[model samples]
Target: MTGAKELDRFLAELTTERRLSPHTVSAYRRDVGTLLEFCAREDIESLDQLAVHHVRRFAAESHFRGLSPRSIARRLSAVRTFLAALVEQGRLTANVAVHVQAPKPSRRLPATLDADQVASLLEIKADDDLAIRDRAMLELFYSCGLRLAELIGVNVADVDAADRTVRVTGKGAKSRVVPVGRLALEAISRWLRVRATLVKGDEQAMFISRRGKRLAPRTVQARLNHWARVQGSPTRVHPHMLRHSFATHILESSGDLRAVQEMLGHSSLSTTQIYTHLDFQHLAHSYDEAHPRARRSRRRRQKTK
Candidate 1:
């Protein structure tokens, strides 16, 4: 089969059988597509002709082109998945990417907004419809700690105003019920009233675009950047930052790791444990500033005495 045909088949299987999200499917397509390009350059046409060396070289080239280790690892994982699927389907005998390993991605701490920063962003009022919609989205993002895809995928029926809980479909098509802050619920209620004025069709989407259609992830990102600037944020705020803030703030206040894991919908406690490091960092900074034994604090206190 041709490379494109194979990719199409694999993607169809991903959607129908694996039930993977579109974002994940696209990432696999791009990674496997890059492998095909490398095959063409190396004069290899068939899946049986692929070798572990070629896969390693592709990883090397990606690194040479300045791709991050995490990105390279993700690309390798995609190629590995594709090759494994082909083997399972009797299309190939050996997996080319099985032996090719990517570098371990460095674990960087998540960035979060302080409570004051969040309050300022959410407190700003919206006069226009677009701004009103954006305000609702912003509130929901922090209120529920939703992933970008989950937030955009929310429908009118997913929200229960009386319960103050929203049903969000997350990664792997898993649904979870999460609480919504009163402010976010109020903002959503306001947007629902003005929503009909903008929507053209019988769209069930909770957040509609200016064209009266479902909102796009890119549009949400662009709006977030705009609002970040307008709100005088030091850096351009993104959706995941809001999620990080939600996790960090909640963990700091409650210190209940299990509760936070449920709220964030993490399948593993280890996955949710990253926020504990963030919480500790916050505590260390506070201690440094408030404690007299710290170098800076000791110097200041001695000078004052």
Candidate 2:
């Protein structure tokens, strides 16, 4: 089969067999399209004809085309998975993409709001329906360390007020129960009371728009930025920042990586361990500013002389 036809079959398997998210599948489609393009250019017509050198050249070409290291790595990963599937199906003798490597991408630390900053951001007044709804959304985000998709997917039935926990469906459709903070529960309670005033036709979403439908992701983002500005925050706020802040704050206090991992619905401990680095970075910053022997403090003192 042609590479294009093979890609279609692979994508179908990703959707049906693997049950990957639409967003994830779409990314695979885009990434594989680049590979097909490379094949057409090289006159390589079949998956079995692909060689390691071709895959390496594909990565080099992608980099030269101005793709970042992360993007190139993701594309290479997609190619590897696609070719491996063909190998499993006996359509190819081997997965040629397996031996290729992309440039290593530098990992940047996730930006987070400090405790005081988070407090200021969440201190929004509930003067109106929208304000009440936004306040609840913000509280629930920071309270549970939920991903944006998980937060948006929440329904009224998912929250257990008596248990003080929320049932969230996270990545790969995995479900987990996480504790809700008392303050977040209070905010949600207040929002639910006013929710009836705005809800239209039997919407089940925990957070709804003014028209009573499930809140769109863009709308949620816009509302968060609005609250940030209204709260006089210096840094622009986003949903993920709240999640990072929640993880950081919890780790700072408890130092329980496993607990934070469960709450954040991360499938791997390493994914959750990034917060440990954030905690250490915070401590390092404080030390640099306060310690008499700190290099930065010492430099400042010497400059004063």
At residue 1, give the lDDT of candidate 2.
Answer: 26
**Which digits, one per residue and each the tens of the lDDT, describe model 1 over residues 1-305?**
23777889999999999999999898888888988888888888787888788888999999999989988988899989998999999999978788788877778998899999998877656999988999999999999999999999999999999999999998889999999999999999999999978888789999998889999999999999988888889877889999999999999999999999998989999999999999999999889878868867679888999
Off by over 4 Å in 2: 1-68, 71-98, 295-305
Say what the RMSD of model 2 is.
6.8
Residue 251 in model 2: lDDT: 94
Error of 1 at 225 (Å): 0.7
Residue lDDT tens for model 2, 45-72: 7767888899999999999989999899
Q: lDDT per prediction?
A: 0.90, 0.91
Q: Could you estimate the TM-score for every candidate?
A: 0.68, 0.70
Residue 41 accuracy (lDDT) in model 2 = 92
- Candidate 2 residue pairs that clash: none
**lDDT: which candidate is best?**
2
Give each model's clash number.
0, 0
Q: Which candidate is the best by TM-score?
A: 2
* Residue range with the least summed lDDT across 10 consecutive positions in model 1: 1-10
